[model samples]
Target: MLATYPIAATEQNWISATLLGALRISLETLQEGNAPPEFDEALSEEYREDFLRGPKFKKAYDLFIAKCRPLTVDQRAQVLTALNEQNNFPGVFTSTTPCCSIKDAFPDVHSAANELFKHAFEKLSEWKTPGCEQTIRAKYHQLVDAHLSHGSCPFCGYEPLEAADPDLVDPDLDHYLAVSIYPFAGVNLRNLTVMGDKCNRSYKGAQDILLDEHSARVDCFDPYGAEQVKLSLEGTRILSGPGEGPAWVIHFDPDIKSRNWRRVFKLETRLRANVLERHYKKWIEHFVSYAQRHGFDITSTDGAIDAVARFKETCEFDSYPAIGRLKTCFFELVEAALNDPMTVDRMRNFLVESA
Candidate 1:
């Protein structure tokens, strides 16, 4: 991921309090062998009437009752304990050394719990703030605008992130730890983030980040607090094999976190198709144009090398057009290649021919 955005404290607090309050009340009522209350009285006194009367709330309550009521007394106690632990979501999330697995956390809990949590997320729009009158979803985007003003998807750093407005389309809210497989984290603000459509639906759909296909535990970047991951093309080389174009032999770091991130998002394939292959020629052309505009003698080898180095220095990782890191690395590779007189002559010839 390219960046991290702040969670809206007001929205997070309101939704979590209301939902957790309702769930606790319903579970406690069921523990006493009674059917949970309908709507107004289901949640705590502080949050009952304002946010829990809607159809979405009713549906979520119904799902919980159907799933949890049938559990044995001991089972209900275990689930309640899990929910209590989940209340400390921030600690559980940040202290996760490698990653958290739902199976390990709730080993003996009923699988139906997953469905209940899923239902709550699906109806997230129903839980409105008390006086603000905006759904949690709507308020989240307003927070996004404030924090993530870069206007690019943090996941891929290539696509434009749409502004969330009532009149405009909202960006896709991705559950970083996918809600379907991970229970009790579906509604946590720390677990949710706005991702590009391609990264969310196309590449990372339902894929478990905690465990690989072989079920081995792996570390992944925390979407909320991860450092900006760097990409480098220093050791990458062009292959001499026959194909549509020069086949890139890209080498990535062997660290577990980097490997897991690359595998989960298919980053190599995407970086090649979306950034390297699609933009290399244009980048070179732009370099030549920049050199000409800056009064560089591109026909000379030393001047061409200087132009490449200066252009590379201008690339910023979080710049407007996106893919700045990759562009910088690509130019570094170009600058290195310029050390070869043959490559320099090719660049000079291309500059003249294109002119």
Candidate 2:
């Protein structure tokens, strides 16, 4: 619980990588590494007869299968080990056009990959089916196991979030790079993470988390990295961005670099929910009451910031009000507001101060 917490990613992070590779092998076998639904039969009659129906497509597909197939246990380990590596797939597609190859009539990689996963996901529906079921079931069972063991959603650590692959068994794996924008990563293993429904569906639906120069390794919120997100508060609202903000009302950020993350995930709205607002207000109230009880002047901004800093120092990010990192950042707000007498009085008034 205390050592390496859910900063970078969960313990089951490797499950997606392995499954993705396994699925790709099976998926390609099903598709011949060609188009997903129906191959471009219209490309040419030669393609239609030979590649589509004749031995030509079968020949190419079989070659790819042989190339990727593992014969021995060591070969299997080597294949999986290679697959586990992050492709940085988005970066790999440096071409201006959307397609992987220009020769094909409809050479677009995005739609290709997207449809590939769409079919692959269906294949995952049951164990009886070859490609999809085994991997999807494994993902589901992992989530069920994690939830049962941890009690709290390991990803966000806030709500007693449920984990089930709703699309198959649950919708827990959020493509770190939303598959809609960067569909090339549709099957990329490291790109997917085990997330709660609230974090994945309710908040981050097609929003791109990888915009700007924000590297997923360094910036994105997963179970890896100790300091991926830095939270701060302006008044009662919590934010994560470039610097101490002039502040957004909840749906936005003043800084552009930080804005994409907040925008995609709707972090501002989630962080400033009424429940969290109450907790933030209560913290300010605690500080104010403590000052008043000792006849300490909060007008002394340094002292007030120091007090909040002390509280923040001992507080862990995963604890309640669930937005603890941002709550702790409210210490900065305390200091800023204390400098203005009106803001100070308003804060004091905001306090209920125990009967």
Best by TM-score: 1
**Where does the lowest 10-residue lDDT sum fall in candidate 2?**
1-10
lDDT tens digits, residue span 205-237, model 1: 888766676877665666666465656776665
How many clashes in candidate 2?
16
RMSD of 1: 4.1
lDDT of the candidates, in the order given = 0.68, 0.44
- Tens digits of per-residue lDDT, candidate 2, 1-355, equal 1011232223223323333444355444444434322233222332133224344333433433444343344543333333232244434323231222111222243344345444333433332212334454455445444534444443444545444435444546566766665443454444555556887778767765644335332233333333234444444433223333234343222254445556665555666663355465566666666666756554555555555555556444435334555555666565555556756654333332321
